[model samples]
Each structure stands twice: as C-alpha cells, then as structure tokens.
Target: MGLLLKEVEVLVVGGGNAGFSAAISAAESGAKRVMLIDACPEHWAGGNSYFTAGAFRTVYHGLDGLLPIVNNVDKAMVKKIDMKAYTADDFTQDIHRICSGRSDPELSQILVHESNAAVKWLAKHGVRFQLPFNRQAYEVDGRFKFWGGLSLKTQDGGKGLIEDLRRAANTLGIHVVFSTAAKRLGVDARIGSVRSVFVQTADGIEQEIRATAVILAAGGFEANSRMRAQYLGPNWDLAKVRGTPYNTGTCLEMAIRDASAKQAGNWSGCHSVAWDAHAPPHEGDRLISNEFTKSGYPLGLMVNTEGDRFVDEGVDLRNYTYAIFGKAILAQPGHTAFQVWDSQMIPWLRDEEYREGRVERIIASSLSGLAQKCAKHGLTNPGKFVETIAEYNEAAVAFQRENPSKKWDPGVRDGLSTQSKTKRLSLAKSNWAVPLIKGPFMAVKVTCGVTFTFGGLAVDPKTAGVISSTSNSVIPGLYCAGEMLGGLFYGNYPGGSGLTSGSVFGRRAGKAAAAASKTWNEDIQLLSRL
Candidate 1:
C-alpha cells in the first residue's frame, strides 16, 4: 500500500484557468475541502491558459454593456474608447459559422448566456480588467476604438490571468498541489461511481486521495504526439504543441478506462493555427512560446515549401480563418509554409510577435530576388512562388478597378471581417486583398501547431456529469470541465471561445459536482441500512 492522504469533499484535476475556476466554485458551494492538482511544477502550473493571449468572448452592447463586467480602468480611458455591440445572436452565429454548425447547441447556449457572468465572476474574485489596448483596438484620429466582442483582457496577457486565478484560489483556502500527476481514478466496484483518485506525488510517493466527487478539469491530449498519431492519424505526430507539454491526457485516459466515458465530437479534429516553424516541439521556453507565433497572414501571402499557394489567403479575416490554416500548412510538403509581404502593407502588420527586421527572414528588392531568397531558405520552385505573387497582384489590381473597395480598418469593429476587393480568383483573397507591389519584401517560415483536441468525453449539459453512451446514464460522482469534456466544439472554433467555454463549464461542473456529492453520500447511507 502506498501513502494514504486525508480525504476531501471535492478534487479537481489540472491547475489552469478551468481547474482554478472549478476549485473555487466548489469551495464556494460548500465543499468541505477542495484539492486541486497540477501536473507541472510550481512556476509552470497554469497549463495552456498561461500560454494564450487571454482574450475572452462576451456579448456586450457597446461600451455601456462592458461597464457591468469591466472594472479597474480609469474613467478617462473608458470615455475615449468607442465599441460596437456584440449581441448574443452575433456570438451564436459566429460560433456556428466557424464550427461548421456542429457545436452542441446546449453548450453553446450556456457559453453565450453565462459569458458575461464568467468574466464578472473572475473580475470579482481577483482578476483585473482593461480594454485590450494592443490586440483589440486601432487608433482613429488619435483616439482608440475597440472592436470585436473580445475587447476585455486580463491586466496582462495569459500569464496575468492565471496568476489572478491562483491568487483567488489561495485566498479562498483551496488546497493546490503542483507537480502531481494522477495515476488512477478509483470507482466503486458495484455502484460504478467514482470515489477517489490515486496520484503520483511530486516526491515520487503514490498517494490515494479519497474524495466525495472528482472533476476532470485537466485538459485535452494536444501535447501527446502518440495520441495525436492515434486520433488525428500519421502526419499529425509532426504537429507542434502551442501550449503545455504536461497535458498528456492522463486524467482523460484514466477516466475513460475506469469509467465508461462516452467520447463525442470530432476525434480527428483540433484547433490548430500557423505557428512559427522554428519554435520548439513542446513549447518549453515561455519567452518565445507565444511571442514568436506570427499572425500576420493577412498582410501577405503564404507559400508552401514547394513555393505554391495552398489556400486563399484573403478568404476571410485573420480572426475567422487563422485557426484552420495550420492544417493547410501541415498538408504541404515538409509540414512547412512561408508568409511573404512587401513594404506596401508594412503599416498594417501586427507588432506583437515580431521585431521589425529581425527573426529568421529573407529580404529582397524584386520578385525574382525574393524567389532567390526563398531558394536559400529551403523552398523549392522559387520561380513558381514569384509567379504566384505576381498573378495575385495582377488580379488585385483588376478587381479594384471593377469593384468597390474599402481600406482595411480594424478598431471600429475590433478588426472586423474583410471582403473581396478583386475579382474572385480560383483561390480568391476575399478581404483585405492588397496588391504586393513596391519591392523590399520578406518571408517567415511556419507550420501547423495543435492547440487543443476538439474531442473528449461527453457531459450532461445541465449537471456536467459524464454521460455514459452504453446506458445513456450519468457516471455518478464523476464530472468534467475544460478540454477533457467534449461536445462543445467540432472541426473549428472562433477566436477566444476556448477560455470562455472552460470557465463557464468549469463553474457549472464544480457546483453540480458539489451538490451531487451530498446525494451520493445519502445514497450510500440508505444502501447500508437496506
């Protein structure tokens, strides 16, 4: 027998935003004690939430709507900002549009309804809020205009959000253990109810932690290449992870085996994006993990290693199309692609992920010169690459003469979607299609990076209980949240919905699990008497 730990009323696995939210909500709901565990070491405890930009999607009626959920900002700052209303319909439509209409309607309803509540809850706890200055706004006549429903961000980036969650958890007296991995999830022999968790402690001791209920808030299996190869097929093993390496899907696997967890959603699908090809395999370094990810695909054109365009670069706004573009890159030879842009579109480029004139880049003065630079950087058929850009530019010019065009604007609509400015090409650049003229161009290489698996165990919408497909019944005393619980998203997801889904479901899961724990205890007592 290994070490036996004291029992707790609720046990939450994972220490990221979802985990912290569940633990805090459970404690507030009167769980006698709540124990939260993280597989990573102390400093790296936030999981994927730490590695993100920390944008949240909430429905708001312009600036006045934000006033209820937003705080900690100066009145002068608020007065200067102009925002557009992002109603529930807009949020719902956007979700289904990107998800290809496969997102669970029940879960989507919860996400949209409680979106504001989730933001306000975290803000009430410990998180600070400010209008996202850099990512969500553009300067208009010297004043900042905020667009997108994703205007409010944590005081800092992803790091600050998780830090605030951790601070709140500590203040509420929730017990958190880092560097602890769950080895087993114990279920009742006869009742088929989860009761305890067995964990490998940081010090190498196997500890049995008895709890009234367990919430699998850990995350998806994005970091496990073997699992990726198994679910997403052969070439996916080559995909880079955009977040934590510790999210190896241990808790999800253990629950599936020990309990009859019904898997749902797209097993082969995930939320992937074009990340820096030079970034490390598992995102080990924090300094460069998120910073090096270039999101300026709209400002230029993407060419595969074969020096050919795979998809229409301007088919949609970067916000709407970026998540799905990584797979196109993955499909390319060598699982790589390059983005090329010229001086004409320089001002519209993002300032976040790159240092101007730095990082790995091939700069040139002419189309052929750029092709030569591409050849040096391991691209094949450099001439074809230059030809593609020239063709694209010619089409852009022709389209502009025939159709009305709008200058690319960002702030008024939080970087709203762009429309085709030129005649539709075979792969038409729909929006923000600027001709790549005036040389002094550059290219940065990239590839597919998986963020989270879009598939996991299905949960009951009302109670957050794992729903058994075998019997269509609840797995008693077992609950789930975060990436481990599925049926919310399918092939693709809108920007900023992942974090919001986690928080909304995490809150519900914790409250439901705590209440169910009491029911389980009473059932046991009644059975003993019988």
Candidate 2:
C-alpha cells in the first residue's frame, strides 16, 4: 500500500505556464489548499513554456490600449512606433485561415475574447509584459514598425516568464513538488469522479493524495518518441524536441486510460519550426532556448540536399509561415535544408539566431562558391544550386524592371514579387523579392524541431472539464488546460496564440475546479450529517 498524503482542495499537475496559471488562479479564487506537481527536476520546471519567445497575441485597442500593460515602451519612444489594434475579428480570421477552418469554433472564440483579460490577469499576478521590440519590429524610415499582430512579450523571454510565474505561485502559498511523477488517477467508481492521484517521487516512494478537484495541464506528447511515432505517423519519432524532455504524455495517457477521456484535434499535426541542425535532439538548451530557431527563411531562400529550392520561402510573413516550414524541410531529402541569403539581407536577419557564434554560418563571395561550401555540409548538386539562384535572380530583376514602383519592404507584404507578365519562375516569391546582387552570401543548415502536439483530451469549453469518451459527459472532478486541452488549433498555429490559449483556459479551469472543490466539501458535510 502506498503512503496516503494530506488532502488538498485543488491539485494541479505540470509546472509549465499553464499549470502555474491554474495553480495561482485556484489560490486566488478561494481554494485554501492548492498543490502542484511536476515530473521534471526543479531546474526543468517550466516545460515547453520555457522554450518559447514569450510572445502573447492579444486583442487591444491600438497603441493606446497596450501602452498601459507594456513595460518597454515610454512616452518618447511611442512617438515613432507604428502599431494597429488587433481586434477579435482579426484574431478569429487568423486562426480560421491558418488552421484552414478546422479550429474548434467555440474554443477559438473563447481564446480570442479572453486573450486581453488573461494577459491583464497575468500582469496583476506580477508577470511582467513588454513590447517585443527586438523580435517583432523592424526599423523602417527611421521609425519602428511592428507587424505580425504580436506586441507583448515577457521582458527576458521564456526564462523571465517562468521566473515570474514561479514567483507568483510562491507568493500565493501554493505548494509545488518537483521530481514527482503522477502515475495514475484515483477515480471514485460510484460516480466516475476523480478522487485522488497516485504519484511516485524521485526516491521511488509512492503516495496517494486525495483532492477535491484535479487539473491536468501537463502538456502533449511531442517529447515522447513512441507516442509521436504512434500518433503523428512515420518519421515523427525522429523529429527533435524543442522543449522539455519531461513532458512525455504521462498524464495525458493516464487520464485517457483511467477516466475515459475523449481525444480531439489534429492528431498528425503539430507546431514545428526550422531549428539549428546541430542543436540537441531530446531537449532544449536553457541558455540558448529559442535562439535555436531559424526563422529568417522568409528573408531568404531554402534548398534541400538535392540543391533545389523546395519551398516558396516568401509565401507570407515569418510569423505566418515559420511553423509549417519545418515540416516542409523534414519532408525534403535527408530531413534537412539550408537557408541562404546575400549580403543585402544579412543585416536584416535577427541577430540572436544568425549571429556569428550562435549558428554555423557558411560564407562565400559568389553563388557558385556558396553552393560549393554547402556541398561540404549536405548539398548533393552544387551545380543545380547555382542554377537555381541564377534563375531566381533573373526573374527578380525582370519583375523589378517591369514594376519599378513596387519597392522591397520587410515590414509588410510589399508585393515585390518575382512573377511578371513576360517572365515567371516556377516558384515565385510572393513578397520581399530582391535580386541577390551583393557578394559574400551566407547559409545555415536546419532541421525540424517539434514544439507541441496538437491532439489532446477533449474538454468543455466553458469550464475545461474533461469530457468522457464512454458517457460523453463531463468528469466531475477532472479538468484540463494548456496544450493538454486541444481542438483550438489544427494544421498550423498563429504565432503567440499558444500562450494566450493556455492562460485563458488555465484560468477558467482553475476557477471552475475551485468551485467544484467547494461543492465537494458541502456534499461531504451533508453525507456526514446523514
């Protein structure tokens, strides 16, 4: 028999942003005893939220509305900034368009509508917010122009985000146990309600903790190679994990097996990106967390080992296209691709990712020389690589000559395309097209990094209660949030939307779970009198 621990009013599993959000929200919503557990050690606490850039997409009324919450901007600097209000309609359309209208309509609406309130609530809890100046804005015409519908980020990115959340959780007196893995859910057979959780500590001591309500925000199965191969299909097991190695879908599987949880969303789909080919395979680097991301492909071109351009790199803004491009690269020969850019675009690349010591850079003075250098890396046909660049340059020059009025602008979709009436390349760049005339080109090798799996347990939109697969009804004491609660995203995700979705549903689940705990106490009291 396992050791039985003290009962708690609310129990949260997972220590990422969503778990912290649920734990903190539960404490604030009148839950007296709240406890959180994480499988990872103390140092590996934040799960995937620690590897993000910390950008949050929220609906705001232009610069005026955001000025209050953001900490980086001031009265003087705000004068030169160009920002537009992101409305609910715009947010809704972006999710629908990016997911190809497959996102759950109710979940999408809740995410968009509650985004601002969620951010504000996080701020109230001491999580700092700032404008993502370095990542989201580009200085054009001596003024900072922000695009991609993302304005706020944590001050020091994901590291600071986790630190703030930990501080807030501590302040609320919420107990957190690290290196404790939840083994299974203890369900009451009478009503099929979750009553306790069986967990094992690092020292191999097993214990059962009774709880009034249990919230599962433990995350998806991206880090579990077996689950990835089983659910996400062939070669998915080979994909590098972009986050914590501890999120192996243990809680997700436990809930499904023990409580008959219904699963939903794109099982084969996930959020992936072009990552440094030399990065670690199983986990993210704490010091260089998100910098392993190679998102500057939109400013350049990507070619496979066959030395052929496989994707139209400039199909959309980096925020809109970066996630899916990793899958495109993974599908290429050798599961790798190279992003190439000339001297003109080199200065425009984000320094955190393209800086000299950050990534392995291949440099050469001419296209042939660049291709030859890439051959040493992985390029199989250097001659074809040179020919591809020559054709693209020719089409770019022709399009510019025919349409001289259209100028290349990286801030928006300037429509400096490589397609024209007289001349058209087989794969034309849709925007920010410019001839690579300057010498000294640069390239970087990249592969796929899976962020999180899209498939997860189906839950009620209002309360985030886990829906039973058998009875098709809500489990009395089972709730889910964050990536564990899916159907909000499908094929592709809008940048910064994951964090917002986590916060929104995490808060809802926390509040609802707290209320359920109160009801459980009242019922217990009535049964005692009987």
Q: Model 2: per-residue lDDT, tens digit, 425-505?
A: 888888888878788999999999999989999999999999999999999999999999979888799999998888999
lDDT string, candidate 1, 168-201, tens digits: 9888888888878889889897888888998887
Q: TM-score of the candidate numbered 2? A: 0.98
Q: For model 2, what is the error of residue 428's alpha carbon versus the real structure, in angstroms, after optimal superposition?
A: 2.2
In candidate 1, stretches whose alpha carbon ends up further than 4 angstroms from where it belongs are 1-5, 68-73, 356-358, 410-424, 520-530
lDDT score at residue 459, model 1, on the 0-100 scale = 90
> Candidates' lDDT values, in order?
0.80, 0.91
* Poorly placed runs, candidate 2 (over 4 Å): 1-5
TM-score to native of every candidate shown: 0.93, 0.98
